[model samples]
Target: MQYFIILTFFLYGLVFGSFFNVVGLRVPTKSLFNPKRSYCDTCERTLTWKELIPVWSFAVQKGRCRGCRQSISPLYPVMELTTGLLFAFTYYLTGFSPELMLGLLLISLIIPVTVSDIVYSRIPNRLLLFFSPFFILYRILYPLSPFYDSFIGAGFAFLLVLLIILLSKGGMGVGDLKYYTLFGFIFGFSHFLLLFFLSTLYGALAGGILMKMKKAGRKTKIPFGPYIGLAALTVFYFGEVIISWYLNLFL
Candidate 1:
């Protein structure tokens, strides 16, 4: 039974990963809602059903468009596979619960934002905006917790990032501030501060490594959304455990 659930989760990841590819490719160009089938950008030919299979299809085709034999970007398969692994891991961690559903939704939001920010150095507000309502809905579905916590989280995170931006003389982008609001709302006030602290630590460590390797210049900007996404995922999976550990350290 456990094996079956894991297999199901893997298959689910593959399917959603395919959809995420569409979202990542189209959302940035404002073509996500277009009523057209997927097509090869190089050849302008509609992709066949076989070509549309997630990670395996790319590998089978040698990462080329069948119609034109143009070399497709490896990023497609990488994104698909990454999402698939992350989704499966998330399911394994959360199982089939409301938390799992919310976790999946959060993961979906993170992938596009991560991909876009890495490629374009900007996160679309539209994507972050979409996550806002989910906070309210989460509250509705799980009402034992106070909805006000979400608002408090949002406000606190916004102010915290805003202060950092001011101190750094416009170092932070507005999109990041908006994105934190979603994180704050979902995480709530109780855990939001820890999430921010941990995310900032991770982001700084990552950025510092990139700088040391000379892959990024000292002043070269790195997107913060991915770090927030990572921190959120961590909190979702083990918030109580982490909080308890922190409290134990002091006590």
Candidate 2:
């Protein structure tokens, strides 16, 4: 029964991940609702329900569009599979609770933003706007949760980032600003700080590697949103363990 429940959530995540691929692709283009259907990006043929079976259909089609036989981007199946695994991991860590559900929801929300940012260096405002209400609801309903911490996190993130943006004369984009503040609200202040620290470390490490490889220059602008998302998700799961270790050093 436990395995069955976990499998169900995994499958459910894959289904939602498939839809998230569509949202991530379309929302950036500002065409979220007009077509109201999924289609091949290359061939433009509308995909049937049978052709839309998460990772399975891609494997069945051998990762090509049925209409045009053009190679499809592997991102679709990869995102589906990744979401499925992440959801299963969340279930393992959180078991069953409102926190479990919210953790899953946060994953779903961040995936699109991360993808969009990595691909285009632009996070869709619509995606963030859509999820913001749920953050508020999470605070109201789960009053015992770290609501105050998240509030302070959001405030600190926004003002500090805004100051940096001003000093840099637009070195930071609005999307980055909004994402940092919103994630602060979602994860609470301490976890947000932890995530921010980890994100900085990740960005620095990746940048150093790229520079060393000559794949990027000192001035190359790499997207930071994806790193932030990765750090946030990691901290969400292992935050208590990480925080305790850090505190023990001083205590």
C-alpha RMSD for every candidate? 2.0, 2.0
TM-score of 1: 0.90
**Residue 43 alpha-carbon offset, candidate 2, angstroms:** 1.8
Q: Write the residue-wise lDDT of candidate 1 on 1-251 in tens digits.
A: 97678777877888887787677667777678888888998988988889998888899999988989999888788877877777788778878888788878887888888777776777787777786677668777875267678888989999988998889975678878888877887888868888888889999999989988999987777878778878888788788899999899999
- Candidate 2 positional error at 23, Å: 0.7
Off by over 4 Å in 2: 144-147, 169-171, 211-214
lDDT agreement of model 2 with the native: 0.85
Tell me how far candidate 1 lies from the true structure as C-alpha RMSD in angstroms: 2.0
**What would the per-residue lDDT of candidate 2 be over residues 158-210, giving only the tens digit for each residue?**
98778978898756689889988988887777878898899889989999999
Q: Per model, how many backbone clashes are there?
A: 0, 0
Model 1, residue 57: distance off in Å is 2.1
RMSD of 2: 2.0
Evaluated at residue 226, the lDDT of candidate 2 is 78
Output the number of the TM-score-best candidate.
Answer: 2
